[model samples]
Target: MKAIVATELGRGPRGLQYLDVAEPVAGKGEIVVAVRAAGVNFADSLMLAGRYQTRQPLPFSPGLEVAGTVESVGPGVTAFVPGDRVLAIPAFGGYAEKVAVSAERAVAIPADMDFVTAAGFPVAYGTSHLGLWHRARLRAGETLLVLGAAGGVGLTAVELGVLMGARVIAVAKGEAKLAVAKAQGAHHLIDAEVDDLKAAILATGGGVDVIYDPVGGALFEAGLKCANFEARALIIGFASGDVPQIAANRLLVKNVDVLGFWWGAYADKAPAVMADSFRTLIGWWQDGRLKPHVSDTRPLPLAAEALELVLERRSTGKVVITVGD
Candidate 1:
């Protein structure tokens, strides 16, 4: 097998090595997948820098989500068999030719969904669906504002927000990115590079009942000023590299709720909720309501370049690495 090995922490993507490695074998209750494609995420950079919440030991792969065919199954695994097409959240080690994952964490992808789209589906869509439906309880007919609307999770938020019947205000850096957001179902688009975010959001009328924020920092502060009374602001991540310091006084004045969400935590604390979330997302996909965007596809040898695309915010939706034919 060939894998991307991170030699040391803080070395960043440059430290990664694409070389021959021992193939992974299925352990008890686990399954070995012949990796077809893997999704690149911002967390991969954080993990390499040892800044992410879930830290792996040195010399590890950084990919989080992948899609592939099952190669083998370990004892106690009955749901999947060899040659099944599935998508999985491996937590790590997805930037390789093969990965060993728990059978419970793998889901059979729709027959019609291509491998690249399936590879990008789990994390970004799962975050938006779980955050909006389960955590925030977003009501239909409400106004929803999404920050970083052109990025991976942000784009998904815009799509799901509209599908759930909310008026979506997408905020991104430029027209091209906003155009992508519009195609994804954003009713209104704000150029964060020029327009005043707070004013742009307020201009949408009725203010904003819910805000899905993945790029924090200044945008988070601006969103607070535009939030409607009793609105919920879901904090997905700080992609802008500056974590916002929330002022409790603003929350008191508007009766707003600042909800922090981590979609990966649900896999451990509430597997049932995670399962249901996937079921709903898959249903939406089958109905043609959900379309995953894969903006760039790179081969395994260029895995570092794929991560660079995410780190530099050059790609929208998701950047996928094609691991094998």
Candidate 2:
């Protein structure tokens, strides 16, 4: 088996060194996945740089999701068999051609969900759904604002917000990204790089009912200004590298709630919850109501280049690495 080995915690190229390794055997209650595709996420870069909250042992793989068939099942596993198609948000070790994961952690892929697309769904879409549906409790006809709306998690929020019947106001860097968000079901767009985000949201609807902010820098502060009474601002990430400080006075004045979505932390404890969420997302995907956009798919050997593209923020939507040629 081959894996994009991260021998040390640092940035890409300096930390990542691909190498061959002995094939893994599934322990009890685990399954060995013949990974056909792997999802590239922002967290992957953070993990490589040792800057993420969750740190792995030295010399580990960085990918958090994978899609493929079960190559083999462990002794106690009964939910699936060899060759069963599944998508998983594994704790780690997804970058390899094969990975061993607990059977409880895997979800059977829908027949209509493509492997590459499924690889991207569990983390980004799942996180978006959990935040919007569970935490924010976003409702129909409400106004929702999504910052960094062109990235994976951000785009998923746009699509899900539309499915939930919210009038989505998307904020991104440029026209190209705004176009992408509009095509993915966002009702309005804000070019924050040029125009003001808070003013745009205020002009669009006076205020938004919910704000999905994946990049928490200046936008976090900007997001606070465009909240209606009881509005929920979901803090999804610090992708912008700055965790903006919030004044309690503003929260009190606006009577708004600041929510956080740390999807990975709930790992083993939230498998059943996430699985249920996946079922709902699957219906949308099948009915054409929920769509995950894949911007690029590079071969496994080109994984380095794919990371580079994501690091540069040049790629749009989800980037998948096809492990099998």
Candidate 3:
């Protein structure tokens, strides 16, 4: 099989090479998938630079989520068949023609959803849904502020926040990106390049009740200052390359809650919750309520370039690597 192999680390995307590799076979309780498309994430660059939490051995493929057709099923796997279309969450190794994942980690993709959309669905959409609904308990009629609103997970947060009945304030770098957020149903947009986020957020709705931040740094700090009393701030990630040091005084004064969330952890800690969340998301997708924004699509051999698009923040929404026809 052809796969993009990462033979060394600390070299960013340049370390990856498209080369022929041994194919995988389904093991017990697992299924082999003929990958159609793989989702490129910011973490892929982190993993290559050796900054991510999970580290693979010397040689590996770097991808987290993928959508494909089932090629084969191992013993004890009855949930899927050879022709099933599904999305699988392999911890890594999705940048390949085929991958073997535990059946429990895979979900059947909706018949109407294309492989590119399904490839980008799980991590980004799942993160926003879980963070806003489960962690923050965002309510309708409340004000929701989304930082990095043009990015992959950020766009979903903006869309879902509005769908859940909150007035959304989207913060992004420029007008082009802000326009994309507006198309996603954001009620208000803040140009992070010029506007004062704190003032703009406060001006938009006095203060926001729920803050969804995937880009941490100055923006996170600014968003914290504009939080309404007892507001819930969800820390999704530090995409800005700088983690914020929370001020104890700020939390005490506002009685605010800083909720840290990592959607991947739910797959192991609470598989049932993960399953239930997917059921809801899929239903929304089926109804045309959830539209995945894939800004770039690259072929398998150009996997490094695909990762670069995400790392450089040049692409809005999600970037996908098309693995199969």
Tens digit per residue, CA lDDT, model 2, 1-325: 7898888776574567779988989999999999999999988888888888778998888789999999999999999999999998778888889999988878898787788998988888989998999889999989999999999899999988998899999998888988999999888888877557677778876788898988988887877888889999998888888987899899999889998778876667676777778788877778877768889888877787877777677777889989876
Candidate 2 overall lDDT versus native: 0.86
Tens-place lDDT per residue, model 3, 20-45, is: 99999999999999999999999888
> How many clashes show up in model 3?
0
Provide the RMSD of all predictions against the true structure, rounded to 1 decimal: 0.9, 1.3, 0.9
Per-residue alpha-carbon lDDT of model 1 for 1-325, expressed as tens digits? 8999998999888889998888898999999989899999999999999999898987788889999999999999999999999999987999999999999889999899888999999999999999999999999999899999999999999999999999999999888899999999999989987557787778877588898999999998898899899999999999999999998999999999999999999888998999999999999999998978889999999999999998887999999999766
**Full-model lDDT for every candidate:** 0.92, 0.86, 0.92
Candidates in order, TM-scores: namely 0.98, 0.97, 0.98
Output the worst ten-in-a-row residue range by lDDT, candidate 1.
193-202
Q: For model 1, name the residue pairs that clash.
A: none
